[model samples]
Target: MRIGVLALQGAVTEHIASIEKTGAQGLPIKRVEELDGVDGLIIPGGESTTIGKLMRKYGFIEAIRAFADQGKPIFGTCAGMIVLAKRIAGDEAGHLELMDITVARNAFGRQRESFECDLEIKGIADPVRAVFIRAPLIEEVGPDIEVLTLYKDEIVTARQGHLLACSFHPELTDDYRLHQYFADMVEDSMTANL
Candidate 1:
């Protein structure tokens, strides 16, 4: 299986390392053309507004939206989650607008930047470890969205069909189950298309 990490910004290398641990070839997607070579794509943690501007500047907005329309799975972590959401809490315009959810940027507040916890994701058993650093929170989810893991009654991880998102930095931790989960989604999408 092959997976691509959005290389426009964020923890590109770290995500690649974690993806490789899942026995999948991880590629860095710098250009829109690079999207064709991967079965699934990951948008890692980074500043949301900057990532949005860069994506627009590089022509990834339409390219990635097309990629998702092909039924290919897209996983967004942290600010990446913000990128996918259809709504942002403030007046900030949404980017990609792929997932039917609303997100609050920097929802964790300034005091708890390095908060860690074990979360019980919907699919994965035995609670997965999650790290929150300037993470966004899923304020509300539409009917299409499936709530995965919640932190203190707030939505942190949720999946909608082929698109998956997490408010915290799942790539920062050693856990690869979330990556595996996304990989499986990609693999499944490939098979169903056949």
Candidate 2:
């Protein structure tokens, strides 16, 4: 399977490395046409506002939404999670608005407050290492959304069909299980369509 990392901003290389660890071909996607070559996409952590602006400026918003409409999986990490959120606390507009969740930007506090922890993610047998840096929190989720991992009683990871959102940086760690999980999602999606 091939996976594409939305290279608009944030942790693109780390995400690519993690994807490659799963024995999948990983590519950086900078243009809309690049979307056609991948079975899955990962939007890495970064400044949500900037990523949103760039997505709109480069016409990626519609292209990405269309890609997801095909039932392919899309994983969003940290700021990328915010991008996928249908509603953001204290904000009127949201980017992509694909995932059925509400997010609070920087709910983990500032950069100085960044921290790491091992989290018990649903569907994974062992705890996964997580790094939160100015991360958002999933305050609410739709009925279809499944809460996956939580940190300190706050929702940090969730899934809704083919979409996965995490408020922590999974790519930043050596553990590739989460990436492998996403790859499996992509593969399953491909199989279901066939």
Candidate 3:
């Protein structure tokens, strides 16, 4: 299976490294056409507005939506999570508006406030290491959304069908289980379509 890391911004190399650990081909997707070669896509953390602008400027908005429309899995980390959200807190315009969730940008405060923790993610056997850096928080989720991990009772990880999102940067750590989980999702989607 091949997985793509949206290479427009943020931790792209780290994400690619993690995905490769899952025994899948990891490719950096810098153009809309690259989406066609991957089974799943990972949008890494960065400035959401900037990423949104770039995605739109490069004609990736429609292409990625179409890719998701095919029921292929997508994983969004940190700022990428904000991009995937249908609603952003404080009435900010949403980007992809794909995942059925509301996000509060930089809900964790400033860069100095960034921290790391081991979280008990749902469906994962043990705690997974997570790094929260000026991260966003999932304020609410739609009925179809499954809350995966909560830190201090605040939603940090969630899943809605083929879409998965997390407020923390999982690729920053050596733990590849979360990436492995997403790889399984991509693998499953490929199987179901067969």
lDDT of each: 0.93, 0.95, 0.97
By TM-score, the best candidate is 3
The stretch of ten residues in a row with the least summed lDDT in candidate 2 is 88-97
The order by descending lDDT is 3, 2, 1
What TM-score against the true fold does each predicted structure earn?
A: 0.97, 0.99, 0.99
TM-score-best of 1 and 3:
3
lDDT of 2 by residue, 29-140 (tens): 9999999999999999999999999999999999999999999899999999999999999865989999999999999899999999999999999999999999999999
Question: Tens digit of lDDT per residue, candidate 3, span 14-125?
Answer: 9999999999999999989989999999999999999999999999999999999999999999999999999999999999999999999999999999999999999999
Model 3: CA > 4 A from native? none
Clashing residue pairs found in predicted model 3: none
Candidate 2 residue pairs that clash: none
